[model samples]
Target chain A: MNFSYPEFLVKVSENCIKCRRCIKECSFGVFSWDGEKIKINHEKCVACHRCAACCPASAITILKYPVSFKENHLWTEEILRDIKKQADTGGKILTGCGNDKPYPVLWDKMLIDACQVTNPSIDPLREPMELRTYLGKKPEKLEFWHDKSGEIKLTTVMEPQIKLETPVIFAGMSYGAVSLNVHLILARAAKELGTIMNTGEGGLPQELLPYKDHIVVQIASGRFGVNLEYLNSCAAIEIKIGQGAKPGIGGHLPGEKVTEEISRTRMIPAGTDAISPAPHHDIYSIEDLRQLIYAIKEATRYRKPVGVKIAAVHNVAAIASGVVRAGADIITIDGFRGGTGASPKVIRDHAGLPIEIALARVDEQLRKEGIRHLASIVASGGIRSSADVLKAIALGADAVAIGTAALIALGCHLCQKCYTGLCAWGITTQKPELTRRLNVEEGALRVTNLVKAWNLEIKEILGALGINSIESLRGNRERLRGIDLDEVYLDVLGIKPAGR
Target chain B: MKIDARGMHYRELNERIHDAVLKGIKEIDIVNVLGQRYIGTGIGEKVTINVYGTPGSDLGAFMDGPVINVFGSCQDVIGNTMNNGKIVVHKDAGNVVGLSMRGGKIFIKGSVGYRTGIHIKAYKDQCPVIVIGGKAGDFLGEYMAGGILVVLGIFGREKDPIVGRFIATGMHGGTIYIRGSINKSHVAHDVSIEEIDENDLSALKNIIQEFCDAFGITDPNSILSHQFLKLRPKSHRPYGQMYAY
Candidate 1:
């Protein structure tokens, strides 16, 4: 289909003084002074309604495109119902993809059962349930024999390793993309929570070096700020193949955000635009990927695990299998619903596949190949409550990474205004004043609370299935039942219909 | 010590290098080196190593303090994560060279691969340098942090630009001195490109002259004859105030 710009326009009335108030308030550059009144560029707008909310004159109105019979047919009552549901929850809107609200959230159709009869729910406080998981390749065989000194020596291929106290991990958000304070909070929270936070393709900050043990340093196509010390310091090294929000595209940190501190942290010259190309120029084939994987293994001396994170696409299962064979200890699949600091609205909406089907297919493929244990799978994109976490595990995910959810816990309203970088909530912006809005203490607490709640829900789900551990539920499709899924989904998930 | 690595597999080469380093062999030379990937990767201490022939991808990747001197052409990701020490390559280097270096210096006597010095940065005292004696491929110094990158295009008498399209695309803090003319349209809005004056040339002359001195060039004069281009960031505020509540 031919791409066309949205027909609707948003404008602030003549009442606006053009004092650049909206400019200062917005994180996304939606409204700009056109030498007259503040002009609203609909193309740049994420429909976050942040500008409308912050407008003092209340003169701004976002007009929707006039719908002819053809356009009106595209609208459904279900879409309106979903929007209302999000509004009814708390007047807080939840959305997936780059502000486009038409996509289906498969998680809503899937439900989790609670323990009542035959199985009893375990109190997480009283009974200890392990969420910890080890990510790495396991040796198939070991040849052991007693040496001349009477000590047993084993000849086994050394495999890399990374230990996680919980299945949840903080995904890659670079120091340059966000703020130093945000990285600090994530690092501190990850350390305290016994999880790991990723240093997105941007280089690791010096402040984050202290928490290196809990960091997953990323090396993307741009290869920003990566070095031996940065690689060695992290518990895991993630090769960022692509991001869900904007797949098949590279990243560009506008020259405006390349501050001195960020520049120093990222090792780029300050004030210069940081552009990450769409693809790793050198990595053309799976063999090249394998070379990089083994290269990292050789660099770290097989001490730390290596992860390859790619956006969920049409051929994700096949791609994941290649990654496994390429020697990745873990594969992180990001769904189309994943968040990004800034991405072209077009790419964000239509590029990648949904996480639900992607996870199931990848799991089924790997299990069939009998190489499922070769690497752990972590799914991200549109993960909301503890039930979603449980469903994901049952669908064959070892863990999940939450970006927008974590930001919400840290006071992000999901206004989808991250592109402009004026995040009033302070979670995404580099502005010092706006950044203070998100108190690190409270942010950490909220994240901890979210994880704790999810942990409890996980235990509850396990109890209902009569499973004692998370590993038991992983890839255990028999415990799940799809409510109104299609035959293809039912077959792929290997689940029966309700009451069947 | 001499090690002949002809026809040796990547794994075997890695094992031999590991064993040699472990044995405390500080200065060793390898002959007929062919496609031995990940050579001297992640070594902590400094070692004076020499390679006679081509080394494969990720050579000296994540190296801590090892000084690797390559006598011939090298493949992709040379000095991938090199922190300290140096990698002096006598021949052309391949793609993604010095991917995410925080420290150390990479001196190439010949042209380099694509995206060379992409996201290269520096800490307090650890500044990384990728000095290419010949022309560099695309995206040279893409997201450079706080290091000095000098691309001295010394391919005979021709006066071609040292870097290709999108050079210093996202450069923020460091200095990149390309010793030739750059297409101004290719420069990003965030960067300010200016002609290198005597002051700037003087600042980098020592390094440029030192590079020429190593490569057996008699004149650093012709190298400085051409005008140099410098790219720097325009603003400290990465993203303007767009969505502040």
Candidate 2:
């Protein structure tokens, strides 16, 4: 029962007021007053800076533990600590919000091309640059009609589309994983930014019913809170096959977090674990997926577009092709390093591929098979900056979804303790006391500003490339060049070498 | 609206039904409805569909508002992912019935196959209900999230038993009422059996009367005399410790 392996060191300065404010503000029990003087428990500190930020005396400083395990390849500090923690507590190794391991990040190695003297780059401050994107299936060919009197008739039917003001959307995060206030903030931001935020498997809370048009409800294997009214209330429905954080694995939201509010929204009993089976029992094959797709289509009367979201596994190209062929109008691919409320460390660190490679391969395969226009591809998982968004579009993505970035805008330091349900930030936890830390109206304004700033940056990039619209940049791999990538990566990305 | 679905394809039949519904018809009767899959799939309308013969699988998948009455037996997935609706069968039913049904009611006159009413759920005011008059195969009401499932041993022989083993496996939510006793070996790990009480009996009787009226079962009073037992999940988080341990 004594498996305390805190990773932070707390230092109290001489300027301490002895007011014990740190003891009161620290949610993780890192600071305490033993009836006399305030004491810091280094073992309990997650370094979330809740106490440090709240302290009025400016007396507390926090740092990582200045200890080493010889730094050997066979015995890294993380490996040693993880083994010790499990051996002592006999608990599953839990982590939050994507892979934090030091893996090779390809986005840092790719560069965008700008126009030279041959083609003058337009000034974004004066020139008009469009960032709008439409997501849905486009027909392969258009039909033409002419009048009998030799006058051409202008007419064509268009399928439903998700028109995004900027090619950025808030990714799906279940209500169980985050507080209701977080959903509201993300919803408000999506509404203001002219994008969408997914109601990840948790179903839409009734309070946010007014923001239904900006919400994308999800249908995972668990079928939580899925009903006729809930399905009809969203802009679209996403069939969640897998997530990058834990591909091919199931999900279990602990019973302790399922309060009355979460229980009502998820439509499950309070204090019961909400478990999602790894796969949909009925959909064992692509044909079965097609059946469910059409079933939803039939249910909605073909009004809203239906989408499929999958993790970027090694063979994602072929899987995406099968998904589109199965009648999905939009495809969402989550790469490794995607965020999660809770996931096993082993799976989060080692399961899936990068979004860049997966996006390139899927687009190339879809284009090669003459089915590129069948569905719109939305890339997700670890899209950090506006530059990454532009690079994803160049690699052939209609849009991108951001999860951890949005949380950062909402005051998350990524201490990576979301699974513990004791978040110092109010974004992830369901506890009433902790969730009160967020001011949703202000948080929503911050998120809206963040996205708007990113949109302006995107327009700047487009203007620098002499491109006036985002559609012209879509799948234009010629504008991107690989720097550190070898021949195979460059070939798979279908881009030239940087020097070339 | 009437359709002679003899040897007609399911697509064409569905199209005709869709057109008829769009045309504002409130009732449709289909004759010779044999082995046609997805009969009322994805139909979101308040209407009545009367089927003369046995229909195929997925009778009302993702159905929102409608009533489907089958004069004969039905097949698998009678209400797969159905939201709000009602489906009535005069005789037995097939496998995997009511998979992930959020809200609705299903009544069958006779026995049913395996995995019936798996993952039936409820949200807010919408609670799904499924009632069977006779025996059932194994895994009945497995993984039911929130809803009501009832099985009556009216048509089964004394030795047949009401349902096969492993009933209510992984059932985290909901209640199952059964006439006659179930052996401890037949029950799932997470389920617990309890003696039926007054409120339970009243609810059971109400659903039984509805099922009797739908299936033309005479003397519905006979079902009240049978010893009814209730099965519910022992814990909402049955596997909470499995992952950590």
Candidate 3:
């Protein structure tokens, strides 16, 4: 019944000093004492490098297993493992974080263009590059009127806008999924970075109400903690239609994670499972979605912009346009590689399409219809670094949301065991003992440092393109070139093929 | 503050209502509120809204802390996702009553349309309760996860069924109490019907009295003459093993 096997082999180097630091620093309980020698438990190792990173004597060496099974492309080892796992647990294979299997990462296929001899590259160290962007609907046309007092005034109606010092915003992660300290760290980091962090379906906690302006509250099918105050307290509201990790499925946070604070924040009874329905019972169709969107607008008195987050399905272009026409000020598309606290492995590993093509399709569809100004498009899911961010922007995303990267900044090794409720790093678990591992002050600094570094790299890329502002690079697909891509992909991506 | 909503559009009427509420208007009397969708929605104040004519669907959806009093009936989806508020309908209401309601109380004087209190949820101290005075149509309290729903059948006792087919279908949590008896074929598979206990009746009395008082009932005991039936979900995680995680 034991489907689990060691994926890595624990190798002890000849330089072993017997300091036993590995025994102390290994959080996965991989090292133990057996009589005279320290015994290594290969079954417990998740290859997180905690012991290796902390080893002062350089005595610990971990190596991946040499061919767990005969590598058959048709019947891959993952498929066999999944089958075995199902047989062992007799339960659905639950996974966390993003899709870890090898798939086509479109960002690596497409390249960011820099100014060469034809154009002089601006030095980012000395020159100024603006990354500030406003996310919301923009007026298609402006009109002015003169009153009887002889004073002229601009009479154009404006959509509520969200101002971001940088194009990146932290994706919505519920309080129950992560610890309260993690939420505080994210809120403080976002405030310091002059950006926003979304409070997922869970409402804003009482202590985090002071950071309301930097938070974007969400309303999903479950309508968890979605009250007038919860909606009005945030800078914006996101109606979660779907997510990248599990596009068609709903979310079920187990009762074990619903502790006291989580219960209060989500406004549910403690030790009760929170089940988010797959679809909004009210939103039967696109028009139904429009009603909810306008309902939120009316509820907020039109003070905050409303965004709709959807997965990158096959019909993203049409779906994006529908969302825009339905009065959404922002459209967030989460690609197939998005992360989650818990999702069925079947959908996470094989569900939605890559975001690069989806973003290009949506942007082109909107621009071709001459209604691109109606909403800002945000790309998310698998944004790893500034290079990925730049690639996403060039493909037509106005901004990006990062979830897995933010978790990694707080020391997540991406072991993909997030559903187990035993994260030693304290990033995913809600248990007090495990959550206490993260120091809020240090975690906030790490998140801040990550954002700052990414921002600096973004500015450098924009400067190298001779573009002074990030806006100039948006939807400029011509500035990008595709490597080893066919004509169909190039046309779909709206980018020129290499050696054109 | 009193306003005539005879010819006003729903958006315009809602705007004026929001403006008045923002200006600290404690009470508002809206006359001729015909088909104005989402009345008093998003109004986050301790104000009272009195409606004269037929109001629209979603009358206090996502409402924070306002008391809505309707002199006439509501169309559909009343108290949809209502957070903490009171919606008192002096007459009968339409379909999907209290749909996904999280908290607060909804009181109706007469019969309701189909799918009353569907997905009515509750958490912690914020438990939503809906009291329908008369008979209800099909799928009453369908998919209800938390909170309480009571169909008094105050008027339709002899003429029709107290509640219609597929009652409490897909319900995982919460309790639904009908003033009279129910048939086994009309209920959902996951839910079970049982005799109302002393504690359940005691808890339901407070909610019933409030509903009766809203419609100016002389005696609450007369309505409690019939034995009550309670329907609750047998399993909390009914679909727990449907999908592979």
Candidate 4:
């Protein structure tokens, strides 16, 4: 007996010309063309709307299934559905994407300040607004001296920094989780935007080697495809300690998804589960992390900056500080709202801290320790729009990483069914027919447009705030205020109330 | 080139090695190398390095292509994530030897500490091989995905068991060969242990012959006379059934 209810109601309107396009367009197999007319099994609809959008007559309609259980606040339809699913399968309920629970979104509760007639706003249209940002360790102080020839030379040795035309970068999304076309799009967009795209755990394919200058290769616990060439062929190295979606848990990419190409790229067998353990078995302590970090530095001959990425947990500040002291040039803090291709639903919704509080506390703690300049902080997870990026920078991030938002720009409807390997948008699936639908050039253009629009909006907001440089806004919490937020959150965020 | 790293820091010693390699030095020897870490790290050249004294942790880490001959013992993580190279250790080594090594061959003349050969994997043709002349500590070959691991247990430690408990735990790929028998209770549940057949014996013979030649042992046939038990993961996907999907 099936105890599941349809989440969406699909209807074929009277305007249907019976083109049979819906049956072919829907990768989820929601619609079927009978001998007479088109019929829909609403249970299979993920609400991707590819058919509705592609229809010439616009005959298809998709609506949320107008059904409800008993009026119980504690046990909502989502809770009951999950319970029923577990009861039926006796397996852990898995989900994709970020936390969907209605926890407080601190970004919405925080407001940015604008200069009102006192410090006159700068017109970004005509003025030179600086958005060029560099990510890496900075020396505590700079010293310069005039040579005998009367030319000033820098005395302090500067560390390697990753220059970003804009402070926003594409987050790490692996190849097996998404298709190669998606990676191509990200790499192309990153090159055009002058920002790096992370190769999340999955190894960089041979074709993407041309974009090596704009790629940050990730080394996860699985150690998949991590070799000398892979390590050296990147702008920077990111040792992924944990992910925000599934903190303290390992990742298991099933054998079914491990195609021959994926196997070659990851350097694993063609049909084996790529299991990334919870922790790097050898890295048991902070000292061990230091050893690994220094080892990578030694391997790269100190050319590229090495970073450590950890989930934004309760003690994220301390952990980030340890990461910096352990010789990391960058620290990437991923919050609970970070997206994943697939993860256990229990951990996805319940584990890790929000990026807002995590970034603020980490910035505050590192500043107090007087080693904030030792490494650049990249705050990720749940950055929605340009306003969120600005707020993140003001709260203390040197830059921000966007994953879900970037996917949305590439036609992701956020149905959260990426685990099924049946993405109608062709963004997260590897099936040949589905993956071919995502034209790499079009996807790259969309991502490039999104980043450009966000960058322009950021400049507009900076002009209104009377700041011409993005660096001047970083860690400038005085330019921000908490709106209807608790005193504890305000204190942690290092901001006052809205009226103040 | 000869480097006397008596009191030199790991960084300086490694930098010297890097410089020597860059200078196209084919062969270099370091005498009195007392605990200098990351020796020959990331050196992709086909160079040979001979170490007189004990090297420090993470020796030959991420080394693409190089040969390291160690006269004395080594510290922990001797070949941490080593890519392609040959590391021949004369005596004992510390824990976590060959951790996550994708491609390489590590030949130890004597015993090794705990968690040796943990998480070592193999690519298409680049299969990593680790041969222990003596015994291995606990958790041997834990989480091994691909590659071959052989524990000879021939260096005067044959009275006790060859390997410690929880052998090949969570191992999904790879093959483990241990000379003599192992207590079945010590192995993981998903692994299968069986006596070597003709083909297995032939491959094991080649690996043993190489291990003996590395240490200049006279009797390769003596080690071959003993029965070898082969350990392999029962299924390629160990956690295939644990997931809901």
Winner by lDDT: 4
Of all native A–B interface contacts, model 3 reproduces a fraction of 0.49
Runs off by more than 4 Å, candidate 4: B156-160
How large is the C-alpha RMSD of every model relative to the true structure?
Answer: 8.0, 3.2, 2.9, 1.4
Q: Alpha carbon lDDT of residue A397, candidate 3? A: 90
B142-183 in candidate 4: lDDT tens per residue?
A: 999989999989873656577888899999998999988888
| Model 1 chain A weakest 10-residue run by lDDT | A90-99
Question: Every model's DockQ, to 2 decimals?
Answer: 0.26, 0.42, 0.52, 0.71
| Residue-by-residue lDDT tens digits, candidate 1, B1-245 | 77889899877877778888899989889899988888888787778889899999888877888888899999898887577878988988888888767788888888876788876766667888878988887788776656888887875225545677887765666788887777777666778888777778787787777777666778888877777788776753333322111
Model 1: per-residue Cα lDDT over A256-299, one tens digit each? 78788877766666666676768775577889899888888887
Best candidate, TM-score-wise? 4
Model 2 per-residue lDDT tens digits across residues A1-500: 65444678899898898999887777788888888778778998887888888889898999887764566897887888888877776777888988988888888989999999999998889988888899898977777788899887656677888888999999999998999999999999999999999999997899889999999999998888876787789999999999999999879888898889998888877787787878876677898788778777766767899999999999999999999999999999999989999998889999999888999999999999999998999999999999999999999999999999999998888888888888888888988888988998999999999999999999999999999999999999999999998999899889999999
Model 2 chain A weakest lDDT span, ten residues long:
A1-10
**Which ranking of candidates, highest lDDT first?**
4, 2, 3, 1
TM-score of model 3 (CA atoms):
0.93
**Cα interface RMSD of each candidate:** 7.7, 2.7, 2.4, 1.3
Tens digits of per-residue lDDT for model 3 on B42-90? 8778899999999887788888789999998888877888888899998
Candidate 1 vs candidate 3, lDDT winner: 3
Candidate 3 yields a Cα-based lDDT of 0.87
The reply for model 1, stretches above 4 Å from the true place, is A1-100, A111-128, A141-158, B1-26, B44-46, B81-84, B95-208, B218-245
Q: Of the pair 1 and 4, which is ahead by TM-score? A: 4
